[model samples]
Target chain A: MKPAIKRIIFIVILVGLWELGSRLGLWTELILPSPTSVFTALYHGFADKTLIWDLIASFRRLAIGLTLALIIGTSIGILIAKSKTADDTIGSMLLALQSVPSIVWLPLAIMWFGLNDKAVIFVVILGGTFVMALNIRTGIKNVSPLYIRAAQTMGSKGIDLFIRVIFPASIPYVVTGSRLAWAFAWRALMAGELLSTGPGLGYTLSYASDFGNMSLVIGVIIIIGIIGSIVDQLIFQRIEKSVANRWGL
Target chain B: MFISINQLNKQFLDKNDQPTTVLKDIELDIEKGEFVSILGPSGCGKSTLLSIVAGLTSATNGEILVEDKKITKPGKDRGMVFQEAALFPWINVIENVMFPLKKEMSKQEATAQAKKYLQMVQLSNYLEHYPHELSGGMQQRVSIARALAMDPEILLMDEPFGALDEQTRTRLHGQLEEIWIKTKKTVLFVTHSISESIKLSDRIIVMGTRPGTILTDIKVDIPRPRREHKEDMLELEEHVMSYLKKEIDKVVSEELNHETSH
Candidate 1:
């Protein structure tokens, strides 16, 4: 059978099993809501426009945070790659900071920016920046010296060399960095949103859980997982593959 | 002399931080439109000499002058082709050729110049093909086209065909010879292959290892389309090999000694 068809069948079987267990009273409806009820909650949430607002708000924060992270991360990455002092100082600091989970910064971010979008965005930027910076640094550093010498002999120097040779050669790394940053930022967003009062997937998930609306909680969790996979597999993975193919990395 | 190296010296600190001389008292000169090859075995610093002349490496002492002007850094007047093609993998054939011309000409003019050289190298059909898509010989051809597109006063090539199979190397020799004849560009070619130096050069400067110095500077008077002078080419190849044999022996013994010592 076709792989797509096989996957569909597998999903159907899993959902059928879950529905059967729910009907058989294997557990309370509050603990293990049937897939139908979860889908219904999803439908109602979208119909009420709450899910739409939540998605918009979540995406807006993500876009802003990721953009800022990429710009700042790339700049710092270049600095670390090029300068010995920066590599020894800020580079080491970044390596250390990358180990700290993004959610661990929630208390500090909340204290600094209050329980607002700014706090969540701050956490998201932190989540993405260190990994992006490290990847970019590695990317630039790993550019073959042969290419640099070739460019130098061709009358390329300074900014021209970086833009034409180094940057393009390091594109495979940048693509990888962006993919990792997206994942990190996505996780950070969810964690930060849990404490946030604003309209967001995490906020709604928490609200549903607190109100014992197990179906709504399950629906929101499914939405988060689907969005995460869709963005990664559809967008970032495609970009990475094309870059590797073209660059022969 | 169009290009001259006067008492050029290069020293590198070895693993123990002791300065080891790589090239010592390397003096040579080349006339305009002359094809000169620096022939040596590995560790002979022939590539270093070429790199210094290309202004990609600094000489520890003395200097290289192009058209009577001392050169300290890489310039548009001197173009270098490394052993590896070193074409930008991200760019297509035409774009790689146009790279050096970006600051010198408009986009359309640069494209025209790039296309012209790509045609000269017989890669006009592969203009949009990325470097990764091309074979090794084709990649080297693209690099040669890229270097030629700049219209430099001197062309510096460091064993540009060294990595290729023998058949491909022989084929490229013909193409390179044709290109040289058509352009009459002053060429400084470096190679380990004795026949390659004899096959393509107006003069071959055979180098000795261990503080690399010129062993002999032999001029090839063999007629153009040198294939017609196979006997003459073989005679000179043997002559060049005689000068390199001692150096090659020295390198071999040094390796053997190091291994046994370990």
Candidate 2:
């Protein structure tokens, strides 16, 4: 069977098993909602337009945070890659900072920016930027020295060298870094929304849990996974594949 | 003299901070439009000499001058072709050829110039092809076209055909010879192949290993269309190989000694 079809079948089997377990009372509906109940909740969310608003709100936060992270992360990465002193000083500090879980920044972000969009965005940027910077640094480092030498001989120097040779060659790594940054930003956004007052999926999920709306909570969780997968499969994965194809990697 | 190297020496500091000499007291005078081959075994520093001349590396001591002007860094006047084609994988063949020209010419002119060189290298049909899509020989040809498109006064090739198969190498030899004849650029080719040196070079500088220095410089007086003069070429090849064999043995013995010491 084709891999796509096989994957669909696997998902169907999982849903079927879940539905059967719920029907058999293996788990109470309060604890584990049936697939049908989850779907009904999902349908009602769309009918009421609340789910769309939540999605828009969550995506808005992600876009602002991710853009900021990419800008800061890429610059830091290039700086670390270009200078030995920066690599030793700022680079080591970043490595140490990366070890701290991004969630740990939530309290600090809240304290600094308070319970507003700024707080969530700050947390998202904090979560995403370090991993992106590290990946971009690695990408720059791993570019073959031969390419640099070749470019130099072709009359490229300084900024020309970076733009023409180093940047293009390191694109695959940068794309990979973006994907990881998105994942981190997504996780951080959720944590932020859960704690702060917001109209995002995380906020709705916490509300549902508090009100004992099990199906709504389950539906929101599925939406998070779906959105993450959609971005991965549709955008980043395609970019990676095209790059690999072009470079014959 | 067009390109002159006087009392050139290069050394490197090993991990132990001991100075290891790679080239010593190298002197050469190359005329305008001359095709010179630096022939030597592995570790003979022939490539290093070529790199220094190309202004890609600086000699620890001594100087190189082109038309009496000192060379300190890589410039458009001197172009280098590496053993590995080193073509940009992200760009197409025509773009790779046009890369050096972009700074000097408009996009249209660069395209036209690149096309002319690609045609000269018989790769006009593969203009849009990416580097990885082409065969190794074809890729090297693109690199040659790239270098040629620069229209440099000197072309420094460090074993450009070294990685190709025998058949590809032989065919490229003919193409390279023809290009040399047509362009009349002062060519400095580094190679280990004796026949390739005799087949193309106006002068072959045989080098010795272990603090690399020239052993002899033999001028090839054999006329062009060398394929018609196989017997004469073979005789010259034998003469070059005889000198090279001694250097090869010295390298082998050095390797064996190092291994035993280890």
Candidate 3:
């Protein structure tokens, strides 16, 4: 079977099994909401504009958080890549810091920014920045030394060298770093929204669960996964494919 | 002298901190618009010597002079082409050829100069093609155009055709010879192939390995359109090969000793 067909079949089987189990009363409705009820909840949520509002709110945070992460991460990465002393000292610190989960920053972010947008954004930054910096550093370091030498001989120097040669040559790696950073930012936003009280999918999830609206909870979860997949497919994957084509990757 | 190397020596510390000399007491004077090839065995530091002359690498004890000025760093006076084309993959053929020219000339002038060189290399059809889209031979030709577009006083090529097949190599040799004659730029070429050296060079500088030093500097007196001088070319090839064989044997024996001892 074609891969797309296989995927559709698998999803169908999964939904079929869930529907069968619900019909058989194998589990409580609260534990596992029926797919039909979840769909109904989704339709009602869309009609009331609650789901769209929540999605917009989450996307707004993601846009801001991601922009900040990219700037800070790329700068730190370039600094680390260019300086041997910085690579040796700060590189090790970053490696250690990256091991801590994004959720681990929740307490500190709350303490620093007191349960506001700042707290959520702070957590998102902590999640994405290190990963981006580390990947960018690797990308810059891995740029072919031959390219540098060739460009140098051609009268390229200093800032010109970095901009014309280093930056373009490291495109594949930098794009990959951005993709990973976006993923990290998205996850951090969801985790932060759960605790900080925001108008987002995470906020809706927490609210629905608290009210024992299992169908709404399930509907929101599906929407989150769908949104993530859509962005990856439409944006990040498109960029990666074009880069691969250009570089003959 | 248009370009001169004086008492040049290069040494490096091995992993154990022992001194390892790569090139020693290299001295040569190159006239303006001369085609010179440095021929040697694999480890003979031929490329190193070329790099030092190009000011990409520094000599341990001496200095190089171009037009009576010391070469402390790479300048527009010298253009270099490596074994690999090393063209910027991000840019198209015309852009890459135009890159070095951009600093000195306006965009239109640079593009026109680039177009002329590309046409000289017979790559006018590929002016918009990316480096990756071109074959190895085509890529090397683009690099030649890029170097020529700079209008440097000297061209330093370190085995520029080393990676291509025999057919492509021969064709490039013809193209390079034609370019050299037309441009009349001083060139310092490095290669291991005696035939390649004999075909294009006005003078061949043969070198030996293990503390690389000049073995002989042979002048190719066998006039231009050398296709008519096949017999003379063969005799020079044999003479160059005779000296190169001793160096190759020494390297082989050393490698065998290393393996046996290990």
Candidate 4:
């Protein structure tokens, strides 16, 4: 059978089993809501435009945070890559900071920015920046020495050399960095949104749980997983593959 | 002399921080539009000499002068082709050729100029092909085209065909010879292959290892196309080989000594 067909059949069997268990009163609806009720809750949430608002709010924060992270991270990466003093000092600091989970900074971020979108975005930026910086640093450092020498002999120097040779050569690393940053930022966003009083997927999931609406909570969880996979597999993975093919990395 | 080297010396600090001489008192001169080859064994520092001339490496003592101007660093007037081609993997064939020209001319002009040189190296059809997509020989050709496109006063090639297979190397020799004849750029070619130096150069400077210095500088009186004069080519090749054989033997004995000591 085709892989897609097989996957559909597998999903059907799992959903059928869940529905059968629910009908047989094998478990409380609060603990294990049937797939149908979850889907119905998803439909109602979308119909009332709550899910739409939540998605927009989450994506907006993600866009702003990710953009800021990339710009700042790339600059820091280049600085640490080029300067010995910076590499010894700032590079070591970034390495230390990278190991700390993004959620660990939530208390500090909330204290600084209050319970708002700014707090969530702050956490998101922190989540993405260190990894991006490290990846960009590695990317620049790993560029072939031959290419630099070749460029030098061709009259390239300073900023011009960086832009023309070093930056372009390090693109594979940059792509990888962005992909990682996106995943990190996404996770941070959810964690940050949980504490913030906002219209977001994380906020709604928490609200549903608080009200004991198990169907809504399950539906939101499914939506989050689906969106995460779709963005990573469909967008970032495709970009990475094309870059590898083009650059022969 | 169009290009002159005066008492060039280079020393590198070994792992023990002990100074080790790589090149010593390497005095040489080349006239305008002359094809000169520096022939040596693997560790002879011939590439070092070429790098110094290209201004990619600094000489510990003395200096190199092009048109009586001291060369402190790499410049557009001198183009270098590395052993591995070193074409940027991110760029296509035409872009690689146009890279050096970007500072010198407008985009349209650079494109046209790049096209002209790419044609000279017979890679016009592969203009859009990325460096990774091309064969080793083809990549080297793109590098040569890139160097030629810059229209430098001197071309310094460091064993440009050293990595290629025998058949590909022979084919490229023909192509390189034709390009040299057509452009007449003052060429400083470095190679380990004795016949390659003899085939392509107007003069051959044979170098010896262990504090690398010029062993001999022989003028090739053989006329172009050199393949027609096989006997003369063989005679010159044998003469070059004999000079390098002693150096090779010395290296082998040294290696054996080191191994036994270990």
What is candidate 3's lDDT per residue for A221-242, written digit by digit as tens? 9998988898888899999988
- Judging by DockQ against the true structure, name the best candidate: 1
Clash pairs for candidate 4: none
- Tens-digit lDDT track of model 2 for A147-169: 88777778888888889889999
For TM-score, candidate 2 versus 4, the one ahead is 2
In model 4, what lDDT does residue B17 have?
Answer: 100
Stretches of candidate 4 off by over 4 Å are A1-10
TM-score of each: 0.97, 0.98, 0.97, 0.96
Which residue pairs overlap in candidate 3's backbone? none
DockQ of 4: 0.79
Candidate 3, what DockQ? 0.67
Whose lDDT is higher: candidate 1's or candidate 2's? Answer: 1
After superposing candidate 3, which stretches have Cα over 4 Å from the reference? none
DockQ (Cα-based) for each candidate:
0.82, 0.69, 0.67, 0.79
**Cα deviation in Å at residue B32, candidate 4?**
1.4
Model 3 C-alpha lDDT per residue in residues B1-262, reported as the tens digit of each score: 9988888999988999998999999889999999999999898899889888877788888888899999888877788999999998889999999989878999999999999999999999998899889999999999988888989989999999999999999999999999999999999999999999999999999999998999989999999889889999999989989999999999999999999999
- For each candidate, the alpha-carbon lDDT, in order, equals 0.93, 0.92, 0.91, 0.93
